[model samples]
Target: MNKFTLLNGLVVPLDRANVDTDAIIPKQFLKSIKRSGFGPNAFDEWRYLDHGEPGMDNSKRPLNPDFVLNQPRYQGAQILLARENFGCGSSREHAPWALEDYGFRVIIAPSFADIFFNNCFKNGLLPIRLAAEQVDALFKAVEAMPGYRLKVDLERQTITAPDGTVYPFEVEAFRKHCLLNGLDDIGLTLQHVGEIAAYEAKHRAAQPWLFA
Candidate 1:
């Protein structure tokens, strides 16, 4: 996991609400837990015209030009500006994996499903909740300007708009700390490696007969 400090990147507006995990990274692509190679298939149904399957050549597939992601201006976007109830439906960590793999570091929305929100933190993606009106304002800004971008300061817990407007957001202190230090669940556990090794050694000595 990479530490997320500051991210200044183009924002792609996913206007619809109630975006479920399946929509983010459809059910078919969930078979792999490698947490990678899913970027090309992210939003498969909406991103392309044909039915998407595993191992399909994404490059040759026909893209849906109307989709926000396929729009030329939004290419290489790193921040996702979404509406309420984003990541609703089934709790699949693959949603965040697809987004992160596609290079999205931050997701801004009025609200998010609880499970999906928690998964985002564990997978190194920052899911931000803001006031509904604030999100609406951002959507308008993104539509008004081409190549619009925002600066997200996770430590400061603020988002800076292109016009110098700053919006303050809240994040749990523990989640904030984990992202700042790039510590996932595994990373957190590994911090106690020495103690774990000692405990295992003592257990082996006490239960030598079990091993034999």
Candidate 2:
């Protein structure tokens, strides 16, 4: 996983609520064991009119021009401002995978599904839980300026807008530590490599008969 110390990028306003995991990546694209290449099909159903598959012709699919993500100004958006109950439904890890692949680093919502929120951390994506009022304020600001971008400083737990408006957010200490250090489960385990090796050596010496 990559370190998420800070990010400054365009904000894409997804005003809808109850966005489920399947809607994120769809069920068909779940066959791949690898995490890469899922970005192209991130929002397959919404991004294309017909079903989209890898290597399939994209010219045929009619895009919804009105969709916030389809608009040119919102291109390359890294922060997503969403409504309540974001990332609901099935506990699919692919949801975060698709989001990260599509270049979304942080998601700010009034609330999020417990599973999806947890999945974001494992995949190096930041799911920010903010109050409804705060979310509404962010939506307002982003809507007021189409290309509005926010800079999120993970270390300071602050989000700064282009107009110098800053909003503070709360994140768990453990998650913050992991993200700052770029440590996944395996990376965390490896942190105790020296101690683990010492313990193994002592155990082997103390129980040679068991190994035989």
Candidate 3:
């Protein structure tokens, strides 16, 4: 897990609503839990013209020129601007993995599915919920300018536009703490390593037969 203090990156507009987990990373690619290599296959159906398989050469596949991601202007974008109900449908963690692998650290949307939103925090991706009007304005601003970028400050809980327009967003304090410290579930548990070891040793001494 990576600590997400602040990020300033180019924005890519998805321009669609009701984007589900399967759409983010199709079902076929879910076999591997490696949390990587899925970047190439993110949004497989919409990103490419042909059907996508697990081991297919994505480089040779025909790309959808009309799709926002394939556009040259938005290349190397790290912030995804999306609409309402983003990350709906099945609660697969792969969605955020694909997004993170594709170089997006933060996702700004009007709304997000509950499960997906939670998964983003665990996986080091920042899922931001803002007012519908604010998201619309951002979409417009991103489209109006090429190579548009935004600065996201997690500690300050603010997103600043190029013109210095600041948009305030809310995030739970506990989640903020975890992200700031780069602590995932396992990382959190490991924080009490000494206590866990001591407890185990005490238990072994109390019940030597169990250890034997």
Candidate 4:
């Protein structure tokens, strides 16, 4: 996981609602849990014209020119601007993995599915929920300007537009801390390595037969 203290990146508007986990990364690509190489398959069905399969040469696949992601203007976009009820349906963590791998660090939406929202934090992707009106404004702004970018300050809990207008958002303190330090669940547990080691040693001493 990477630390997400602050990010200033181009915005890409998804312009859809109720985007499910499967749509984010289709079920065919779920066999591998490598957490990477899924970027090519991100939004597979919508991004390409042909059916996508694992190990297929995505470069040769026909792209959907109408899709927002395939547009030249939004290339290399790192912030995803989306509508309400984003990330709905199945609770696959691969959704965020595909998003992160696709170069999006933050996802701004009016609402998100419960499981997807939680998975974003754990996977180092910042999913910010804002008022429906605010999201609509962002979508408009992004579309109005080419190469539109926003500055996200996690420490300040604010997203600043190019005009210096600030929209404050809320995030849980502990999740904020973990993201700031790039700590995942395993990283969090490893923080108490010494205590764990000591406890194991003490247990072994108390029950030598169990160790033997």
Candidate lDDT (C-alpha), each: 0.93, 0.89, 0.95, 0.94
Angstrom error of the Cα, residue 121, model 3: value is 0.7
Candidate 1 lDDT over residue span 1-212, tens digit each:
78999999999999999999999999889877587888999899999999999889999999999999999999999999999999999988899989999889999999999999999998789999999999999999999999999999999999999899999999999999999999867768899999999998898899988767
Give candidate 3's TM-score: 0.88
Stretches > 4 Å off in candidate 3: 189-212
Error of 1 at 24 (Å): 0.5
**Which residue segments of model 4 deviate by more than 4 Å?**
190-212
- Model 1 regions lying over 4 Å from their true place: 189-212
Clashes per prediction? 0, 0, 0, 0
Clash pairs detected, candidate 3: none
lDDT of 3 by residue, 96-200 (tens): 989999999999999999999999998889999999999999999999999999999999999999999999999999999999989877867899999999999
- Per-residue lDDT over 1-212 for candidate 2, one digit per residue giving the tens place of the 0 to 100 score: 88999998899999899988888989988888888877878778887767776666555678878777888989999998999999999898999999999999999999999999999999889999889998998899898987799999999999998989888999999999999888878777999999999998889899978667
Model 2, residue pairs in steric clash: none
Q: Write the per-residue lDDT of candidate 4 for residues 55-147, one digit (tens) a residue.
A: 999999999999999999999999999988999999888899899998999999999999999999987899999999999999999999998
As a TM-score, model 4 comes out at 0.88
